[model samples]
Target: MNPRFTNKRVLLTGGASGIGRATAERFAAEGARLAIGDIDVTGANAVAAELGGVAFAYDARDPAAAPQLVEQAVAALGGIDILLNVAGIMTWGRFEETSPESWQRTLEINLSGPFYLTQAAIPHLKQCKGNIVSVASAGGMHPVYGTSAYGISKAGVIAMTQSASLEFARFGVRVNAVAPGGVATPMHEKSTAGRGVDPAIFAEAAGRNMPKLTDRQACTPEEVAAAIAYLASNEARFATGTVLVLDGGQVTG
Candidate 1:
């Protein structure tokens, strides 16, 4: 099998589990040297062990820690070629029920974290003419009830991608985003658990809301990982500043 990403150095955040973990495995299987980071040291190390890579315990939302993560990844992998910002938190609540702390934390993790990490990694990425793929959300494009902060944060992510693409294009470093909808990840499960939402009712409502697309089946993490891989691969060399929506065609008819 021809590995598309053979020998590439990839730095990924949120590699402890869920979509991030799946992306790590996908890139590893493509023969990429991975530098995985997450708040969970043990989990990150475990994934790194399986992939024959290095792990760093770093909080993506910490501005000061972001550069350290880039430096450490570069030190371990020799240089950075692909940076995947996947660390994020999801809070579900109506605007009235949302607290200031909740809003700030959501934006800090979802928006500010990727911003800081991307800024920190740009130097190495520029050196390698690398690319960045951010995990955004479908909520960013269409308004969803009871997800004010999450939606706003992801919207900011798309905006950031556009701006970064413009600035980095001259340097041959591409930046893009993937907006996934209702993926069957740990984060999605946590966001729905104990929310007083009947599974059948919610599914029915979602199905009705997305009529033109396939049924309300949640996407798999591997599916999202494939999109990320494409955005970060050489095939997308000319693509930048674009938000690829993977929301089961919810945004379309």
Candidate 2:
């Protein structure tokens, strides 16, 4: 670890588990003072305790909660140096099969949640010349058969990153996004299970769909976290509005 984020204040949503948990650990290891928000209070607290950080039980879908999350983070950590929007939801279904409720829920968590949080964090991030990192998905770049809502939501996230980057540039706040493909997270496993298809069959289909540059094996949350950490660090000062894809050569190949 470069310790680039030493003493930095980082606020992360969905810091309870999966990619978010990995990211929280990564930042903590790199010497960040973290404020994590998640609906899973127990899990959040456990991770916070381990990292010596504060944890808030929060549902990111509520717009009003966004400012509150920022306020709490600032109060706990002094100020915000990085804001990472890792909170999201996924709904697996064909476009025609997706209900309006499911679509709304997905958009609320994936798109609106990040929008509200980023809006609330912008002022503080500007003050610190900080950065924002949003976790998007490879689904945003290429269409996946059963990820209509998720893909659309992630696409919105990428667009939001670009727009925010341009708008916040004069304020010295950088915005970027990461799009990961086939990460071996619990979320992925759950999404794939009992879908009336063999796990290996689904895996093979996914592997075949990815670009040649992507590795055959799925990515790990830690690997994605590393990319996120780099983008949030001073090492990427000149980088903004870019989406770094971590799909094991899926997108590039």
Maximum-lDDT candidate? 2
Local distance difference test, each candidate = 0.87, 0.88
Shift of residue 47 alpha carbon in model 1, Å: 0.8
**TM-score, predicted candidate 1 vs. hidden true structure:** 0.93
lDDT for position 232 in model 2: 95
Residue range 97-138, candidate 2, lDDT tens digits: 778998999999999999999999998998889999999999
Candidate 2 vs. truth: CA RMSD? Answer: 2.4
Highest TM-score: give the candidate number: 2
Model 2: worst 10 consecutive residues (lDDT sum): 207-216
- In terms of lDDT, model 1 sits at 0.87
Clashing pairs in 1: none
The true-versus-predicted C-alpha distance at residue 226 of model 1, in Å, is: 0.5
How far off is residue 193 in model 2, in Å?
Answer: 2.9
| Candidate 1 wrong stretches, greater than 4 Å | 195-212
**TM-score per model over all chains:** 0.93, 0.93
